[model samples]
Each structure stands twice: as C-alpha cells, then as structure tokens.
Target: VTLPPKIVPRINICSWTYSPPHTHTHTNPLFPSDATLEMSNLYAEQKGKTLNLTEDELLTFYGILLISGYNSVPRRRLLWSDDYDVSNTAVKDAMRRNRFDEIMSSVHLVDNMKMTADPFFKVRPLFKHMDDINKTIPIAEHVAAWCKQFIRGKPIRFGYKIWSLASSSGFVHQMEPYVGSHTHLVETGLGQGPSVILGLAEKAEVPPSAFKFYHGNLFTTLSLVDEMTLRGDGSCGTMRQTQLHNVPFTAPKTFKKTPRGDAEYLVEVEKLIVRWTDNSVVTVVSNMEREFTETEAKRWNKQKRTMDKVRQPKCIQDYNTHMGGVDLHDQFVSRNRVNIRSKKWWWPCFNWALNSKDLLSFQRLVAQTLLLRHGTKPSRQGRRSSMAVAITDATRFDSFNHWPCNTGSRYKRCKNCGGRTSFACGKCDVPLHVECFKKDHTE
Candidate 1:
C-alpha cells in the first residue's frame, strides 16, 4: 500500500459537528430525505396503497439490516421467533415481521409505470445516485469488473458483471453493469479492454490528463498505452504477450533460459515495454520513462532453498503499489455484507451500495444509534472485540444457561475467530473455542 512517487498523501478528516440530535447527521447521507420520500411514493405506486414510511421506520429497517450482517438466521422471521433462545426482542419491538416483509416487497427505487424492456431498469436509479455522489468528490480513477466468472477458485463466482471506476482510496466513482457485446462501449478500436478503461475514464469527469491510471493485463493494450499517452495521462500495466505486436524483447525461448531476475526491455519514443523473469515471465507496458531506479523483490529460490532478491523495475513497482484500489474496495464491501437473500438480480448490487464501508466501528455505531433511538438496548458486555460479528441473538445474550460441550470427533471452524474447534454450544450447535464461547454468544 505505498503510494506512487508522484502521489502525495492528503489526509482530511471530518469532525462530528452534530448538535444534541445526532440521528440526521449519521443516517441522512446514506438515505437522504428526497430519496426516502421518492421511495415511499414509488412504493405506493407499486402496491396501490399508501405506505407511510416515516424516518424512524426507515432508520429502524436499516439498523436491522446492519445487525443481520453479524447475527444471521436461516430465515428473516427467526429474528422475531417465538422461541426465547432464538428470538430477538429488539427486532420484534422495532417493527412487526409482516411490516418488514411488506417493506421488502415494495422497496421500489424507480417507477414501474415508466417500465422499459431493459433488465437493469429497476436498479438504474441506484447506480445514478451513486455516480452523483462520486462526482461530489473530485479524484482520479481506476477500473475493475464485478462479475460472475467461471474462473477456477474465484471468490465471486456468481454475480453481475459491473464495470466500475474507483479512486486510490477505494471509493467507487462510477459503475456500469456489462450486458454483452452489443452493450455500448467507447470506440477506442484497440478492443473491448481499452474501451472499458477509456469509458470509465470519461465517466469520472476529471480531465483525463490529470490521471496516472494503472490497470491489469485485461485492459492493457499497446495501443491503449499509446492512446493514454495521447490523452496526456501516464499509464502502466501488465500486458498480454499477444498485445505486444511481436515487440522483440529476448525471444521467449531464450528469455526462459536466462537467470532469475534477468530483464529485457524495449524503449520506444515515450513508451517502455519490459519483460522481467521471476517465478514466471512478467510483461509490463508503460508510457513512463525507459530507465528508473531499480529495486529488489524477495523471491523463493528452489535451488538455494531460500528466499533470494530479484531486481524489480520502477513500472512494475508502481503498478503493484497503485493497482489494488478496486480490490481493496471489493474486500471492504464483501466483509460484513447484510445476510439478506432475494430473487431479484439487482439485490447484491443494492446491498453492495449500502455496505460501502466495512468498518465495524462505524457499523456498530450506526446500528446502535439508530436502534437505540427506537428503544433497543446496547450489548451489556463493555470490552468486546471491535469486530461487529456474532451468531446468536443479542436478546439471548443475557440467558445465563449457555455452555460449551465437545463435539466428540468433529472439528469445525470457530464462529468467533475462525480457528478450528471441537467444542460448541450445547444448545445452538455452533462450533467455538472454549475461551470464545461466552464472548461469541454474548457479543
């Protein structure tokens, strides 16, 4: 996570300027007054009746959603279950189960009266709102694809293919869901890859020249690098060998025979292509300078039976340093996402929009603030782990009868810290370490 040489770290923290009533300041940004009013109006239009959703009800619903990220149940109704051990009193007190179900069913973002044949029409408004928010914060951009891929061992195996632009701080600037080849893409003419990069660059609203963009091989073409140079932006990325147009670096056969850390580079006017060998051949293309101060990277050596240092080029170092913004953003969103299931195609993306910040302290603060305003009590445990994770209901936390017992032969991952354990709650049937049993259930 080192920033590139040209980039200077700027820290600007907002103060908690809220007066006595702090509710509006915390919740309003995520769900604005106009947005909420529009949602209620849309609900009535869809359901053929008035769904008078007040500010309190909306905040409570969001609070419940936040809580569910940690305390998940197989069914939503289980939150209000009749069984004392499994039931949640705060949830039951905040809203009726049927009312929750009603809101879920009628949560419309756009009017159905203006329906189109497009699959994305339902959730289009949400993306628009997100993009509008991004415009308010001026920053350079990077790109990534959020999609369901059949790629082996990929974590996100089933999701929509969303092309997104994110800043160096992991803030998403804009997003467009990819449909297919017929879907509109910028005509960079180099291919779909360059087109996506250019499209995202254009959408970011900043002068293209202001960006020092970094991308992976998927979007890096020789022409794309040249195109970025023409647009006055510096660029660097790993390149597919095929996109190289047969640039004569040491021939692939000869390059394989060279010693580890050996590098062959071609310097054209204002562009650089480098092939460096470590465990595998790394081909990097950059519009930056040909020569840069070289650094060393530790690599495992099978022959020496130890880690050895390999020479690393500046372009490769810069790419590594700045290329993880989208990935970091993905990591933040994936963690602590609400465990809400839906048949709608847009549910995951909608949930993603809400869970933008995966900071547990913020989530816990927001959850407690909103829920407590409606009479839900905070956790009695004062010195719990900062992580907002729990498997059991908060209402059941005070039931002093719980204990851990061995599972005899089976070992399962601990619910508290993900360590392997054979011991588990005697009643709940969840695995946990002996020391974590109390904290896990109570927190």
Candidate 2:
C-alpha cells in the first residue's frame, strides 16, 4: 500500500524545537486558581442548583482534599473527630465536615444532560476540557499503550481499568478507559489491541514519523508493524508466537528445549522478529530496528547458582528500556493519590487529575492570595472543637446517680419521652418522671 504524503517538515530529530501554547508572564502563584474556578463552576452547573460556593470555600475544599493524602483515616468523618490524634486542626478549621461532604458529593466536571452513554462518560468530560501543558520530549519516539487492569495482584486492584499512552519519561500523553471491544477505534483487520494504540495516538496528536511506539504481546502483531510503518512511524513490542501468521519461527515448546542463550530471527518485508531464550523465552517484533547488533544482559543461573551474562537483541533491549512509561506514570499517580472514598466512579479519575505536585503549598498559596486580595477569610472559622460526649450504656445504667428530687412549681419536658414532669435528677439536673427515673438513665 502507498504511504500517505507528509505535511509536517522532518528536521534533525535532535534539534527540533518545542513551543508551549502559553508563556509565563510572571511568577504569580494565583494563576492556578483559574483551573479551580473552572472546575468549581462546572461542578455547580452539574449540580443543577445554586451552589453558591465561593473561591475560598472551593480552595478550602481542595486544601482539605490534599491534606487527606497525607493524613489518611479509616472513616472520612474521622478527620473532624474531637480526638486529637484522629482529627486535623487545619482541616477542621478550614471547613466543616458537612460542607466537605457536600462538595465532595456534588463535585463534577460535566453536565448530566449532555453525558453520553459511553463507558468513559463519567470522566470523559474532565479529559475533554484538559489541555496538554507539561514539558514533553520534543520528538516523542518512545510511545506505549498499556492496560492498567483492576484484577488482583495489582496495586490498584479495584478501580477503573484504563488504557494509557505515555512517553519514555513516564509522562502520560493520553488515557482511555477499557470498554471491551468497543473501547477503541475499529480497524477492520487490526482487531482491538492495535486499534487502541491507534486511537490513543490519534487523540494524543502525536506527530507522524516522530514516534516509535512500544507495547507488549497484547498489542503487538505482525500486521500492526506493517500498518505503523506505512504511516511513517516505528513499532517495537513483545509479540505472542501465535500472532506471527506466516513467519516460520520455531514453536515455543520446541524452542524451550534449546540452550538458554539460543536465539533466532527472521526478516519479512522489512519487519524484524527476534526470539531469544534467557529465563524461559521471549519473542519481539519491530519495524524500527534490526537484529544486527546484540547487547549483554545479566540473568540468574538456577543450575550454576550464579549470574550469567547473555547476549540480548538490540530490539529487546530497547523494548525493555521504553515499555515502562505507563507503569512509571501509574507509580507516580498512586504515590500520593487522594484517598477520599466516593460512591461515584468518576470521582477516582477526577481526583487523580486534581492531585497537585506541591500538595499543601499549591492550595494554600492560591487560597491565601485570593482571600488576602478580597479581604475576606474562609466562611467557616476555627472554633473550639469539643468532643460530643457519648451517652454510653455504662453511664446511663449507672446505679449510683439515680436520685430524683422535686423541682419548683413549674414542670419541664422529660428529656427522653418529652413528658412534663416536676421531678428532676439530682445529679444529671434534668427533669424526669419518677416512673422514668430508672429507664431514663439505664435505657
């Protein structure tokens, strides 16, 4: 098939310039508040009511959220507990527990009326309004798409299963939630895996011919390499032996019987396939590199009980180096992830994006600056927090404080049954009936 003509000029890969959409005019920290306002407004619109949430309240909400990552608790309300060990003075002072709950429950990025029936509908709106503002490689040659599943043995074993596209340095360029066969763009012959990579690459706006994509067996296939090569891009990834339709590679079972350092390769229509044995066996495919050069790598020798240096294919070495971008990004995101529990599935994805690098200082600086400029403090001030004494059964059933005495002429309503009574508890000093004297304290 004839390849499409290129419109973008291909310059020296090492010398290409990157220009950001916006340049910094000043070091003012309050600039980040624009995002906060936009998010808060979006949420209010989604709420379908007058939220009346001020900038301070919203910042305080974020401040409390950032603080949660540092101070985790079994129950979210425990953050407002009277117990000094469980409670945070700053969090309690910044906002009330109910207010925090209200914001957390109502916060959203898109209006429900416009939401599509897609699997990613919950968090798609957040991605829709987001802009790429991070410093990325001028020419991102090492791009990868990997599945972050919610299965057991994974760090995040019970969250959204997402497909991510990332750069070599672990900067996530784009993400799409896995939605079965319909999740990615449909390529009639490429199937779901390669289609996912294509969809993410298209969405990420990666420049043609400037990237070398990497993935694992799940996305790699003989046809995928040819398809990518046709678009002036390169492909390198681990491949299943079965995916090689016409290539004559030794069966994995037969290859396992060979020596540990045994290797094989085949060149078909400019595509290269390398199968090597180290621990077990590995097969790699690439349209970008050949098996002309090999590198040495250390492997544990079970029989000899020593480390042995084995010859490794260059394509294999490159795959090992560049395929970890998605994994690295996952590690960074989960390190200080917001732990606020919400029933809304979208909250997790939304919260992941909202997490800032400088957790404490970002919100504090923005909130304080806005407050100072407006000459107003947070709506809720720090009050003397008192523990709500629990009326335990032990205290109620105590036999000693049972004395009841007659009050003056006027009778007051019983604390328990709401009946007027002239009698009162001598110790508790609350009006109670003689009949309820025992049940009032005990039951």
Candidate 3:
C-alpha cells in the first residue's frame, strides 16, 4: 500500500543569514536536530523578531508549541517524527517540576499546626448559589446555618456513607462542621499518615475507631517491615528481624494446598498484620478491637477428585468488598461532568462538588423509591375506590344552569358510575347520578 506523504512545514530559511541549515538538520529522523530551529524561526516569523532563547529553553518552547498545535489528535495518528515523543516527555517533566514549585508557594509547610483551622483557607465556597435561594443573610452566615441544619438532619440514608466519604476525598474538616458530633465511618485512599487520620477523626468528633484507611504501600513501608518478610512461609531473609521489632504477636502459621498443587500460607499478627496466600500484607490502624476471622473458599483438586479448602482473612475480604464504594460514586458523578476549563486552581474542585450534588440528589430519589415500594401500605378500599378518592382529591366542582351531554342514550348513564343519571356537571359537561355527582364534587 502507498503511504501518504508526511506533512512537513515549508520554511523560508533564506531570511535567516546567521544560522546555517547544516547545524539544524539531522541524518536520523528520530533525533531531528532542526526542531528547535524550526520553532525559533516560526516564532520569529510570527512576531517579526528573533527570540533570545537558550538551547534548553528553545527545546522546551518547541515542545509546548508542538503539543499546543496537535495534542488533541491521537498519538498513533499524529504524523510526526519520533522527536515529537522525546519533546512530549520533556514538556511533561518540566510541567511536573513547575507544579511542585507552585504547590510549595501556595501551601504552608507546618508540622503540628492544623491547616483546617485557617478561616480564610476555604476548601469549598460558602454558597454555590446565593441570589435566589438565600437572600436574607450573608453568604457565610447562611452557609453556617445550613451546615448546622444539615448536621441535624443527617441527609444521607443508611448503607450509603461509604459512597459519601469516598466521593468527598476523605476531607473531614470540610464535612465536620456539617456532620456535627455524630460519629461517622470514613474511608480514605493512600497517603493518609497517622497524623492526618487522627486529625480528621478529631475534627469530625469521632474516635479513630470510626476510620478505615487504605494506607498506600509507600506510606505503610515507612511504618512497617518489608512485605516480603511478613509472608507466611518465613522464606524471606528479614523474617526473624521483622518478628523481633515489628509485630507484637504472630499467629500460628496455617497452610492449605491449592488446586494447582501449590501450598498457600496464611498468618495474622492479631489485629495489626494480615498476610494472605497472595503475598499481600495489610496494616490495620484502628482504636476498635476486632477478633481475627477466616473465611473458607472451595477449590477443585484433581488428585483428590474433590473440592479443597482455601482460607482467607475476614479483614482482606471486607477491604476488597467495601473499598470501591467511592470509586462507584465517582463514576456516577463523571457521567455528566461540567467541561469548563479555567486557570483558577480551585475551579476543578468546584466543578467536582457541583457534579457530585447531582449524584447525591439521585441517591435520595432512589432511596425514596425503595422506601415507597417496601414501606407500609396505607389502609384504603379497593383499587377503583382508591382511584376515585385520588381523582376527587385533585378536582373541585361548580354549579351550572344547563349542560349538554353527547351520549346518544335516551337515558344517560352516570359518567363516574354505571347508575342512571339524574344530574349533569356544568363545568365537566358529564351526566351523573345524584350520589356520583356529590361524590365527585363534594371536596
């Protein structure tokens, strides 16, 4: 198949007397040398002046320009040389470095101080909409009042707190005021240190027992021994050292042979460590006391011609089950996300909260539907009687002098009932029995 010609820019190098073309062009297409020169020339042509850029700066600038022009296109379809890939990586690295600088400048680095206590550092706006909903008080005061009311009401239904906690990024201080003194179960992703977890629990007026944190491997490593050492087999070199320094007490080793004829090991260090057969370790930090529990799984055994047993820690099972509630809520929120882009740092967060409210509203509606479906049935007559009652409740009647009925019957039947008609509704223009007319119109 004949491939289309590559789209190369037509540059007028005649105007450039200082730099020679040999200094820019390269033999290899992958490491094209002229990328910087081409960008510099283009910049000069556009602004009608030369840019005094260093070699590194020129490469950086060229990358940004390249991305700005074609980043929207798919990577495979981008008809550019391999140099574009190198430039893209450089641009991303530069951005990451600059982001770190920006964060350091914006945030204060403090050891023991509570950043949430800063009154001016608001994580969320006081009121998203103020003009129509709340006009009597200042936005701040209105927000305060609303928080108190929300706390008292406790808007979320049961079994949905995990969804709420995860979707909010586990920032308890923002929700603490609104949640009041009620203890709540909070779930958080990795990077939450001991200080952060305890601080959030304190602000939320809940004990550490209420928090279930998923500590990241990096953060866990800082506090605990290497995961390899904690494996059940005691094969890793550091097992003896880990037992002496890290664990308080190690459980008796349990073994179960898998269907694949491989032995699986399981061990627990009371409440602290749980090492499963998969060589994964979990470090639980909580104030609540939990007894070690195990669950049995059935596995096929070819030699025995029967199902073999596989043991799993209850902690690991629970973690696996409940950890993704926030993720599910996030997926729901992302479906109708607002696509507005802005330079303001907080705009992304603001957009997220706005989109999240829609999810919460939907959850409430679903809860209501479930309640209505399963809740107590009201004491009433038959279905027809109930329909009559509903229709009567919705409508009212007025008297009229004469009403025409299109019914061809010599003796008209009641519109509401099968009984012979004696009266007619003036407004509805329907003939009705005296009793049916009174039932339909009497309020």
Best by TM-score: 1
TM-score of 2: 0.70
TM-score for all models, in order of appearance: 0.71, 0.70, 0.30
Give the Cα error of residue 441 in candidate 3, in Å: 60
- Per residue, candidate 2 scores C-alpha lDDT tens digits across 1-443 of 32222111100010001111222111111124455456656776665655566667766676666557666788888887766668766666667777677777666555566767687865665554432432232434554566656567877587666777766555555666777754645464687667877777776676667467777887777777888888887787787767876666677888777777677777666777777776677888788775345787887888899998877778777778777666665665566667777888777777766652333455345444443443233475444445434543445566775698998735699877888888888877778888888878876
- Give the local distance difference test score of model 1: 0.66
Ranking by lDDT: 1, 2, 3
Candidate 1 residue-wise lDDT, 1-443, digit = tens:
22112211100010000001111111212645467557766767666877776667777878888778767788887787656556776776667776677667666677667877667877777777777776676564343333333556777556677777665456666677777753445676778878877876677564756467677777778888888889887777787767876576655666666777677666776777777776667778778676644677887888889988778777777677666666666787777888878786677777777777647778768776777795433334223222222434643475776788998846599989998988988877778899998787666
Number of clashes found in candidate 1:
0
Residue-level lDDT tens digits of model 3 in 64-86: 32233223333321212123332
lDDT of model 1 at residue 419?
A: 89
Sort the candidates on TM-score, descending order: 1, 2, 3
Off by over 4 Å in 3: 1-192, 207-245, 248-272, 279-291, 297-309, 358-443
